[model samples]
Target: MSIKRILPLLVVVLAGLGALSSGPLTAQERPGPLRIVIDEGVIEPLPFAVPDFIAENGAAREYAARITRIVAADLQGTGLFREIPKEAFISSVTSFDAPVQFGDWKAINAQALITGAVSVSGRRLTVKFRLYDVFSGAPLGKGLQFAGTTASWRRMGHKVADAVYSRITGEGPYFDSRVAFIAESGPKNARVKRLAIMDYDGANVQYLTDGRALVLAPRFSPAGDRLLYTSYESGFPRVYLLDLGSLRRRALDEQPGTMSFAPRFSPDGRTVLLSLSVGGNTDIYSLDLATGKRRRLTSAPSIEIAPSFSPDGRQIVFTSDRSGSSQLYIMPAGGGEPRRISRGKGRYNTPVWSPRGDLIAFTKQNKGRFHIGVMQIDGTEERLLTSSFLDEGPTWAPNGRVIMFTRETAGAGGTSALYTVDTSGRNLRRVPMQGAASDPAWSPLLK
Candidate 1:
């Protein structure tokens, strides 16, 4: 196993409230195992054309065109589509309902076309788009519409493109979302940290907290409105819940002398599972947010951290040094003896349950290196996804086919950046970041 995945091995099931789509994701969505729906069934890159979208009332003729370009970039980024050059467009579209000249598009060997219109009213912007099968001269799907603030028009465009992808390929959409991570500054040895949230592709970065105090492991709620993290601002490490929308937070525990870390929300979002370290020994506990009740789930002299809930919220997986070295263990959410799940030459830490409920994702440290790995519930067929100098933090892509993690490069100027890889260990690419970034928590696909 590679040394890349050690943190973020905790299971997080984000039951997205407004998103109800089912099935895998299409190529026009976000990058993963993209499902390609071809009408002509060409093995080569499919050619597509997107003339500037129509705009009305001078609201911003360029807004529609800018949106079209973004949509084209989103589609072309998948390495599956070849965009027809804007210069190749012989004629122009005045309206979305106008007849598309197939001869012109076919001359340029375009197999698909995306036509849309953009309009702004008050402070809200509305974008409507439709996908068309150029060769067949038929509408591929119904027109998709998304409305949002003018500032978020780009996201609305991506959402529309995702909808087109879902309709064409019978898959899910992954655009229109955010990513929460720990923004770091200074050297790797003593870095200042704060909770920062940004758009999926590294836009709209908002600092949820100042970098004055040390902060670690910030995670987003299923609804993308709240965050749960561990802060040492109170002199000792304690779990703090910060509401991202209003930037308000209160200590999760009123208890004294109890240090908490590795906090994560349960599948249902009503409770949180965290490791409470007191007097050198650590145990896993659950805290109800509304009732403010605490339940101790594990009681052992050994060190245990990173408690993650299963998709059904019945079992919790955590890491323990009880095996002489750190390894993963699973037990009921309530207190009991934990059953060992990782038995191998290397040590494992940060075990996360997959939202699909098919496997347990974890980090393994072998031969002075770390890796991101996954295994079945019974601890069979252990597959390691990534291996690097210091690869850790495995968060699922909403579809479960890809895992996003942080890879720390070595050297004097060594810095950390986000990377995503498929379960097969193929298609590893650096996720975008603003300055040196680490500890990425992928949000659920937004609606």
Candidate 2:
């Protein structure tokens, strides 16, 4: 189905199955009591408890425990919620329908409490959960239930965490999303690279391409069913579109004398913006997926690449060296005069527009050090969030509250790893991975 038709259906399904808020809070609304407000700067993580879910039958005993652990891990990883250890619990929940003893939870200093039940019938698994305000002695929100195959129990856990996070923070959930990146192995001088996709928390990793071809910048389509990447499989840098389910790929808008790379999809997924290099001069071009027609969006002598569309699809943000240093520029979606957006004293590249449309994340280099930073659309209020030997390729979470990027340490044996940071420039954590990884692109939350 076309993206125009599928987008609304996915939103409806996520609202019904995941039980997320149909209408989010407006900017004028004050945050709830359980909200983790960052408006005043850094704050301590909120403490919460998730007791082991009640196992409805023998078949669900193992799943019940595993899902509860996964749910706790998801919330704790955000650095916004702290999980109280099970050993410190003073109360035991034996029945899903039992009334909660809010006093028992409050004694342990847990501001939030989570209880759930798990059931398994053949290959199908079911989980239902509720969140409570321990001190208020009331349920924070309505109970939610999710069902899927036993193999997908982890996903159901993420859905529950997403719902809880949205209700408490007044922001969209990102736990149910995926990240596509380039996995690296071997020596730094001769690294082997392949395209890989995984859960948002760096679990369930699956490689999409072999190491025979060098690939860079694997970007997901708006629907998360396809990928756009630059590959050297054809002896020259070229753009290729790959189907995630079929494992099939084909060249994209190839031209005989020009090299194409750094491709990204429009918000509607019906068009693509790419960098086309001819005779060493590079510019940005947009291609219509339906008609195979191409239009040039940039016509400067300097190089321009890494084009990303605004959330509303009305404008484009890209990296350009027109100002004698790599910097960010914004232009109308249909092609027009560009305006510089990076005014700070540093070189910037890989400018990615956040899903929230409030900020643009980019990589900055100054004084021989690399950093990840974000700025408003007009390039004001710029803030650098991270600094390291090498930090680049900033991609936004589904909620736009956090960013994931590539960080490389110094030295010959030092390797690259994926890291996440909050937009406020706090809570930097390394993503758990077995090998070097880079060029992360986050997917929209799963339906």
Candidate 2 regions exceeding 4 Å error are 1-32
lDDT (0 to 1) per candidate = 0.74, 0.87
Residue 392 Cα positional deviation in candidate 1, in Å, after optimal superposition = 0.6
Candidate 1 ranges beyond 4 A from true positions: 1-47, 78-92, 106-109
Window of ten residues with lowest summed lDDT in model 1: 1-10
Give the Å shift of residue 284 in candidate 2.
0.2
Global fold similarity of model 1 (TM-score): 0.84
Tell me the tens digit of each residue's lDDT in model 2 across 1-447. 233221212111232223432233332263446777655577789999999999999999989999998889889988889999989999999998788899999999998899988998998888888888788777776677887777777888888888778777778889988899999999989999999988888887888788999999999899888899999988899999987766678889668888999999999999999999989999999998778899999989999999999999999999999889999999999989899999999899999999999999999999999999999999999999999889999999989999999999999997889999999988899998788999999998877
Q: What does candidate 1's lDDT look like per residue over 316-360, in tens digits?
A: 889999879998888987768789989777989888787777788
